[model samples]
Target chain A: MRFLSKALVITWKDALSEMRTKEVLSSVVVFALLVIVIFNFAFGASQEKMLLVAPGILWVTFTFAGMLSINRAFIPEKEQGCLEGLMVCPISREAIYIGKMLGSLLFMLIVEAIALPIFTFLFNLPVLSLQLVVVTVLATLGFVAVGTLFSALAVNTKAREMVLPILFLPIVVPLIISAVKASELALSRESWATLASWLGIMGAFDVIFLVVSFLVFAFVIEE
Target chain B: MGKSYLRNILSAVSFLLMAASLYMVFVYVPTEATMGIVQRIFYLMVPVAWLSLLSFLIVFIGSILYLRKKQSRWDVLARSSAEIGIIFTTLTLITGSLWARPVWGVWWTWEPRLTATLVLWFIYLAYFLARSLAAEEHRGATFAAVVGILGFVDVPIIGLATTLWRGIHPGALIFQGGLAPSMLLTLMVSLAAFTALYSLLLLQRISMKNDEIEIKRLLGLTAERHNTGDR
Candidate 1:
């Protein structure tokens, strides 16, 4: 119970920091919007084609923006030596991982929420469905879970900025592939069964990676 | 070490087996009616692919061993195996592309096998990058080991992706029933040769790594002594 409160407090602290500065969210939003605009201009944004491609475009933007956001996740902690202080705290390392992951997830979700409505308006697609939201949230969960771990790993490297993507893209291929596929299927009004398999894959990947990352985070963060 | 001598013998056997396999591929095995001479390249390409995957598995196992034991020797072994695996993987891609040129009429396609190999290459490249960028000596080994294990998790996925998707690569051998007697024999000989070759390369690379570490250690000790003497 005490651990839960500490986790929540850490999460809140991260959120509060982001809100006060708005640095991560602003950069992510601008980057995502730019990606959408580039895709619109490059692909001509036809309604028919947009419907087919929007899910992928949305996710790609989210992924790139998420990468940018996560690269900064540990920076503030490292810069201020707060991670060391946190490491010396009584809180469990697992709790710290959870807290950081949740913070990242929340930030990413906020960006997605903002992007989705703009995407719908620009592309003239319906974006208010609960199903779409659920898919987005689940996929984002998988992304953030893996991203947080990689973010921590990359932070310690000399080339943290370059190292994150190199470390991330290959490991997360399964998640990205299944997420994009499932999102596309869902958007197409396909039967639930069609999307179920991919969703199951995404869930399994999330669970496996989450557990593995939790177990390994202790070693990774060790001095 | 006894293992080094064993590897030496394995190297000799690999050379002999490869020579025999080449003979069998060109002389004994009849050309396929449809693909003609180009089909024979499969004999080389398939075995190399098999060896590459096997080497990657060895790398993963070596990494786990390194992590568990935290021995520098295991780290050396893992790094050596990965380097050899990359070489074999590169050969597999090249031979595959050459075979595809005449058959598929294109140098490359996003075929499952091809894509998988590309991904595998990137994963290992990342592994090398992770190792190279690590500042601490032991940290490099630990980071490489972790990446090594995690990267291999994609191998089966790639295998499955090839099958599930409309891939131009031939269906996997295991699922397509047994090979013909002549083909099976040729493949067996090739596999044996390549496996031996892999062991040889692994041993050579590991020895090199050990020597490099020893040099570094000696240098560090010398520097320490000079500092103490100056003091």
Candidate 2:
């Protein structure tokens, strides 16, 4: 219980800071909207074609926008030297990792929530279904699981902005694949059995990477 | 003297094994019934692909040991393995493409195995990039090691996800009817030859890394002495 609260304190710190500036959230929201708009021009030729491609478009926007958000997760701490302050506090490194990961996850979920309605209205897809919501949440969890660790690693390197996507996107390819497939099935209102397997893959990905990233994040942030 | 002699013997053994495997693959193993002559590349390609995975495993193990021990030798091992692994992975993709063009009618397909290997390639490329872009040597090794562990752990998940995404039966083409005895023998020889070659290159690369680290140390020592002399 104490550990959970300590981790939540870090998450609350990030949220408090984010609420004050709204820098990461506001930029990602705008960037995601732009991606959807551009993708519409590029792929929106016909109504039928739009439906076929909608799930892929949605995930691609979220993936890249989520990259942008996660990339900023550690930069503020690194810039202001708050990381040192956090490190000296009475908490394990794993706690800090989970706290940061949840912050990014929450931020991404908010961006997705805001984008989904506009996307449905623009693309004419009923992507607001419960199944799609579950798919989005599960897939995004798997993504943020790995993304947070890589973000920490990237911020420590030179050319951090360039480093994050290269390190992040490849690792998250499986998540994107499973997510897109699951979303497609959900949008089509397919049988639960077919959709269940992709969800299983995403779930396995989330569990494995969450544990692995949690274990190794200390190495990345260790001075 | 002793180290060089052992390396020379290893090189010689690798050379002989490679020559014998080449002869077996080209002349001894009968032309496969279905794919015929093009199937010859499979002997070399499969072994190279196997070594590529083996090299990454070495990187993963070396990274873990480096973190635990904080030893430069383990870092050297991880770095050397990653450099060799990337080359072998590139060869795997190219040779796979060559075989696929002749057999699968396209130069590329989103086959599950092929896609997984491609993702593996990207992950290691990012590994190298991270290593190079790090501001300090120890930091680079530490960061790269983290990537090494994460990359290896993700490989199986990537494979599974790709397979599920496409709903394709894995390796349906390669092992359809299984291999003939002679072909299997040839494969065994080739795999042995490649493994020996991998060890030979790894030994050479590790020695080279050691020399490089030594030179850097000596240079730092001389610079420190020069500063003290000025004082």
Candidate 3:
């Protein structure tokens, strides 16, 4: 019960900060939009080519924008030393990881939510379906689970800004590949059985990292 | 310190084993009926690729040990293993390219095996960069260890991805079908030799690291004694 309250409090704290600042969300959305426009110009062609490349473009934009928001998610806590205070609080370290992960996920989801319609309009694809939305959330959850842990790790390093992606992308490549493939399958209205294995792979990745990060968060958060 | 003698023997054995493996690869092993002489590269490529993945496991294991124990020796072992892994991975890529050039008509293709190998190379290179670019301390070691552990999680995925997603790479040796008895025996021998060589390299690196620490400790002691004498 206490842990739940602590998590809620931390989540609210993060959401309120973002609401006031609007720094992370705006940057991610704008960057994603810019990427979509650039991709459109670069790959200008008929509808078939657009359909083929659209998934790749959407994932790339989401990944880059996700990195931006994740990096910023911890900066304020780090700069003001609030992270130290939070660490001293009588909450589980896993709660802290979850709270931060949720904040980043919310920020990323907002960017995706906004970016999707824009992407649909710009690329002339139909709005994504319920199944696609669920897949995106699952995929994004996997990305954030790994990203959250890594961002916490990287935020302590000397080259915090540059280190996150270098540390992250390689580890998360499997997730991105599987997710993008699954997303493409979903978008194309392919049989779910064809993508069942990829979805399983993604789910397995998310569960493994989630547990691993939860176990290690205490060690990482210890100064 | 007495382990130096054992290490020397191990080094000699490693050299002899590598020479024997080379001889087997070139002389004893018959060339493939289809791919001709260039196919012989697989003799080197397979073992090196196997060792490369083995090194990742070593790194992962070493990292877990380091994280649990906070021992500097494990960090050194992990770092050295990762470095050696990179070397073997480079050889794998080069040899794979050599084989591809002859068979696949192009020097390179986005084939799953080739792409995965390239990604693995970049990942380890990033691991080294992450380690070296940080200050030489526990923080750096821990950070690198974490990345090492996480990075290794991709190895099996890459292996599986190549198999799952249809591409030009051959299916995994174990699962696709049974190999001929002679081929399997030869592969096992080569794998054993490579594993022995990898251990030899790791032991030598660990001993060298120990010597370095001892030398640093001796220097510190001498500096402290000299200051006291002067006072």
- Highest-lDDT candidate: 2
DockQ of 3: 0.52
Q: By summed lDDT, which 10 consecutive residues of candidate 3 chain B come out lowest?
A: B167-176
lDDT of 3 by residue, B15-114 (tens): 8877877777777777767778886676677888988888888888988899899988888889888888999999989988888998999888776777
- Comparison by TM-score, 2 against 3, better one: 2
The alpha-carbon deviation from the true structure for residue B139 of candidate 1, after best TM-score superposition, in angstroms, is 1.7
**Clashes per prediction?**
0, 0, 0
Please, what are the lDDT tens digits per residue for candidate 1 over residues B14-89? 8899899989999998777788899889888888888778878888888888878887888888888889888888
TM-score for each candidate, following the candidate numbering:
0.92, 0.95, 0.94
- Candidate order (lDDT): 2, 1, 3
lDDT of candidate 1 over A26-102, digit per residue (tens)? 98898999999998888775678888788888888888998987877787788788889989988888888899999
Off by over 4 Å in 3: B167-178
In model 3, what are the clashing residue pairs, if there are any? Answer: none
lDDT of 2 at B62: 95
Task: Give the Cα error of residue A113 in candidate 1, in Å.
Answer: 1.8
lDDT: worst 10-residue window of model 1 chain A: A196-205
Tell me the deviation in Å of residue B191 in model 1.
1.4
Q: Which structure is stronger by TM-score: 1 or 2?
A: 2
Choose the strongest candidate by DockQ: 2
Candidate 2 regions exceeding 4 Å error are: B170-174, B223-231
Q: For every candidate structure, what is the RMSD over all alpha carbons to the true structure, in angstroms? A: 2.6, 1.9, 2.2
